[model samples]
Target chain A: MTGQSTGQSTRQSTWYSTWYSTWHSAWKEQPLSFKLSSIIVVLVLCFGVINPFISYDPVLDVELSRRDLAPSWEYWMGTDGQGRSVALRLFKGIEAFFFPGLIAGLFAAFVGGVLGALCGYFGGWIGRSLSAVLELIDTLPRMVFLVLICTIFPPSILLISIISSVLFIPSIATIIRRKVEALGAEDYILAHVAHGFHPLKIISYHILWLQCRALLTRQMIFVFSYVLFIETALSYLGDYGVQEPYPSWGNMVAQSRISAVAWPWALPALAIIITIAALLAFGDGIARREEEVKR
Target chain B: MSEQTLVDVQDLVIEFDTPKGRVRVVDGVSFSVSPGEVLGILGESGSGKTMSTQAILGLIGGYPGVMGGQINLNDQGVTYELLKDLPSFISERRGQPEKNERAWRKHRYAQMKKLWGRAITSIFQNPRRSLDPLMTVGQQVKESIQARESHKDALERLNDQAQTEEALEWLAKVQMVDPARVYHSYPHELSGGMCQRAMIAVALACKPSILVADEPTTGLDATVRAQIVHLLQDLIKAEQCAMLYITHDIREMLYLADRVIVMRHGKVLEQVSANDLKEHALERHEYTQVLLDAAGMIGAHDE
Candidate 1:
């Protein structure tokens, strides 16, 4: 009888967990538009990765005779001033431009989220100190600071990415800090403490889960947009991703601008604009889903 | 009269430090709870009943309260001199007072954490705020079980997993309907009586030797109030667990308490057995008469 009862409980627990997981999934499932955009982004990223190794030669084929050739099968995205295939070059630029921004944003979000959660939960002097530091960082012009850091350092893709991440951290931290502060005041946390749950357990299992879910989802969209903007800005400025062997949407547009009457810059420029637009659309969908789940 | 004293309080005083000045809440109160006995503490609002309990739980930190007294729990083999120069000093001598102050304080706190649900548990007045809104009723009970059973061996641990079943059983003990469905529901989903029943299940999860129920039925409806009282009476008799039922209701004191202690303005006005209270209603004391009159008022209100 005892064994049967135990088995029954086990089944009940399994059913409970499965039901909870399904409910949670329903709450968090990405919207159709966001999912579609995400698919496009992934496909684009994959194409960027595979292009150089497959059909396109992004470097080493100087078409001096055919410089600034406009749209044809031989040069699908036309050729830039250096005779590099604008399409293939743009694909190569993905590694230097987009990836760095992605990494920087993610790193910043992670650090900010964790720090904010700790500060909010613990409060008192620790929270105050973190807030002070975050405020000081927030006071600076982050984009200018990123430019200054890149200028001071021997600008590698890694250094630029790190600089971008540093720029992003304080704002994300402040957002997460506010979220944590709100969650800390919840009755569940007090209940956990009253029941003698350890401080670490209360912070980790109760407070972090409560605050991080919505903030992290919101941060993902922010990071995606911010990274794209930073990468494009860097490329436009000619501080990075400008040399002949390197291909970037910003540099291609820059090159196209110089010889606009001779060559059409629309295709590559359109691709850049389209990719950013798609990302923004995707982020909006995600934001909507997050809002719905929060409700 | 001492089979084993679970809690002993002598001249317990609690003062809160406000911006204006020091305000004494619980002044010179003395009481004791023995094993397997119910001690009903009856008091008016702001009479220091809640504050005194909070002091016992060591939750009144930095509230500007000076608690001066000795509280000894014989079952835990610990005595606490509540009011000392430092907060650390009081906590140090809490449970098992013989260990070095610093080490004993750490040990006592740790021990309290371990013993909370198993040896001593509490039921709050507001069941809504007392439970986690995010968690299912079952999970909260499971959490209490996990806390108390942290040190149990494997077979005993299996029994601990049976806590949910035990909790469900306790639901029936509390006269709750459809325990299984109620267990799966959230706090807000349940009615006030059901929520209180779930709280009782959580309190009894670890089979505590002493249960501190802080106004268990104050906010409940009249019908639900009687049911809750009856449920508590049944559980108390069945489990033989000592209970400290804190309430302002004098009738509830007479109905549920083996012995009752009445308080006014943080001072104990009267303490008497339920039988003595009924038999000597007019002659015992003026405070006793006041309590009886209060009970009569509640009876009239019920009518």
Candidate 2:
């Protein structure tokens, strides 16, 4: 009876069955730390991607009458200096942080993937020169550089994301390049070579196919969190980033710069911390899993 | 079975520039295989058997040292000046080598890629490692078949039912019992022998006329090894293809090969028919006699 049922399920599910099994097995195999981090990362990603639809924050809702109120049932986490609901703005703040992070992460991953694969797969003057360029970028002080660039020419949100993404390329590409080098040495790749596969075919099918997904995903998540933190830091510093009249987590906290005892601004600061911590933890888990699978 | 020559390697010399300066790994190695012939290469570690095979396929990287020789595809009437034809990043980095070598290398690689997996294919020494971990045995075989096309043409064509069916047929030809199950399974999911069979299936998928198998059954246990050799022997006969079987096991060569080349110190010492090794072990070259003694084959000279 069970065999018949399994056959029916296999027929009905088709590709989904294999997909689900792979997914389930992967989840089942992860350590507790991986699971916990994955959960935190997933929740943050859900909030980041869907927060716009779920959150209705009036960034321009100036109500001086309700300014500086503490957390209450009606005004969750209280109102900011400009009478903006801190809780509502917190979600919108995530959306602000998230969209930029996503864009920058994607940009970095695309550029990094191509450059790294090419350099590692075809090592010569090309690889060396490209490596030299990456090294130059790598040596830059990311925090100070971004701050200086953004201050010199006040950046729009998109421009800020692009800058962060550009800065991220070196580190991400270094990881990808190292992976291509290591994977190139594996025997399966030699097998592909023996099969008389085109170098491009060997790269795409035999080498990059498995390694790219995990590497890119982990790097993307890391870049996302990195840009989010930098955006917040720049805005909080009052010179660059999302700027005023906007409801980002950083600017909201900056606008609310209150005495520590009152503790209302602490709310936005906490959200930023959780998001960054979750992203790092999630990236770490993926790295660990990648190492394990290589065994 | 046929007199047509398929592959001819002439005076191939491979030198490596190590920390200890230049050293020759394969010195003036020369041999050829006709269609439907099993030509065995017997040698110890570092005998250049594997290197010579790799040199034929341009697997050897251009380095501080160099390779010089010719690997000709007699049937295709194409000659690969194995030395200049393979891409060498090191050569480019070393400054001037007359850009002509690089162009020829690129041109040769492109031309070789056209014939790879179609006219010539290979099975490597390590069976399990030779199969992609993330892919099913079937997918790897199908991809090899697909590689028979132009790169752009391959992208437009995705996995079709016909290719999968053909892949399954190959698995069955390799003596796989449940071809369907094996087709869907990943390399890690199969046993070593099973993976070796799958490797064979993949290499044979495009019906490559010249198959280069480098120690394909080296590490398997006796039973599996015998079966694999038997299966390979049967298939090579059935397909009427030429095979360069590289191994150190003289017994295997005796059983599966028509001609056996004895190698030592990166050079071919003797080329004789397999039957002559048993009947005229001590009567041929000194190296062949040494190999026979090592194999414990008592000859008239042993007394």
Candidate 3:
């Protein structure tokens, strides 16, 4: 009974302490970039939440009568060439961009981490061949290669994300390889081996799991930023991005051109810039925190 | 208990292949360890004490090249070769070292994991870096205890409770007064001496026949070192386990070892019983004589 009570109290204390520290470290005394990035992310999340209820179309619902309008209370971010609410379009664009970026980020990290673990842990012919393939992909111009693949098949958010994830895999894999190699040499890992833990278990649970938690989160954000860049570039070119009627930041900015007295593409362009910057700053914050802990 | 050989390692040879030639790191080293025996294998840093111990664990091949000989262990009336049937290096991959290492590791991992902790365990040199920083002391000890068994329901109720109970018993055995706190704390929360004691508890958790302690007290300060050494000595007697105490501190072996084997450059130069060690006449080899002279025990004669 005494043992149980002691266990409970210790458990509670550890739990409370962990929660308190994470918040204090991540929020309080953080740099300006970290605060600004967090605010941007929260704003984006707010838009994503309210986006589904908003009824606004930038493509087909073209009120030619109200072609160019400035910012107003009725039309908060004004109307575009197609009489679409820019504020409404901004929310939808954020939703479209963030969703695919998130998917691509996860896919890239998973593939990269697994491939890199295999290479570092199980080396030899398998590692060598996979490394060669990664080198082959590394030299190709990302935009041109993505365009080529998209053109060959019907391009959408799914196809573009798949291509971008594949492109990001090698770089992420390289990072994971270096991490795994260094970690594999650590004595604690060898201790696991001495304790009769399986090599696969050692690789997955002990070596990789503990080390890669924060690292993978940071890497995914970086990958998310990359995916965001690719999506916007493809959208601007009017190819391989989300089609018209669906307001992707890329297409909303792409299918419309900038003009004096009416900047149709301005809001989406600015949204793209802010979202990418937010991702980078957030990732950098996490990375910096990791470094501090190491010291 | 009557004297019975728990470990009989025969003519062990460990070699690494370089472009120049096949270099033998540990050549034809052999020793037998009986139960309740504290046999010190004293040598310098590069004298292959640790590498030779790896051969006993079927881990020498984990690096590269060839390892030949038998590491026989007698467990429950069944005698088995710990280093037998391990794949030999093929000449086909003479040019490619990576393929050679990959092939060796696959086999070495399988063979080593079977005999690890259950049959033979080790306490490493650096105690702080040896414990996993993420896991609590209790969790690590529990894993070592559970490793002795084949398999149990990991998610079953009270499984953790039972493991913790058993782990705390080990902590208590290692003379840890506050077992409860030590069990709950992480590696970083403990001092270096405390961590080393925890590591000993971890090693003794399984109650294996042979414990290889490779310079286990190297990093501890003077007072803590004496305490830890005394703790280990008492535990070895109480557990009746054989210990291959590998260390470079030649003078300290007298306190811990019953019989000492002096090694130099991967070869056993002299093996002396503790009684004969005091006589100094048994240390015939020039290096052993030189070491004893350096320790100021044996005077050099102007022959």
| lDDT (Cα, tens digit) per residue for candidate 2, span B1-303 | 123667778888777767886688999998988878899999898998988887777666545333566677744554444344443433443553323434555665776666677678889888988888877777788777777544436566545555665666777788886676777777777899999999998898767888998999978999999999999999998887889998888788889999999899999998999988878776878877777778787454356
TM-score of candidate 1 relative to the true fold: 0.76
Q: How close is candidate 3 to the true structure, as a TM-score?
A: 0.87
**What DockQ, between 0 and 1, does each candidate earn?**
0.26, 0.35, 0.31
**Ranking under DockQ, best-scoring first?**
2, 3, 1
lDDT for position B54 in model 2: 77
Which is the leading candidate under DockQ? 2
Top candidate (lDDT): 2
Evaluated on CA atoms against the true complex, candidate 2 attains a DockQ of 0.35
* Models sorted by TM-score, best on top: 2, 3, 1
RMSD in order of candidates: 6.1, 4.4, 4.1
lDDT value, residue A150 of candidate 3? 76
Ranking 1 against 3 by lDDT, winner = 3
TM-score of chain A of each: 0.79, 0.86, 0.88
lDDT of 1 at A113: 75
- Of candidate 1 chain A, the 10-residue stretch with the lowest lDDT total is A1-10
Residue-wise C-alpha lDDT for candidate 3, range B63-152, written one tens digit per residue: 454456677876645677666664454444546432256656666666666578777888889998889886678778877776765433
Candidate 2: segments with Cα more than 4 A from true spot: A1-22, A53-59, A259-261, B1-3, B64-66, B76-104, B149-159, B299-303
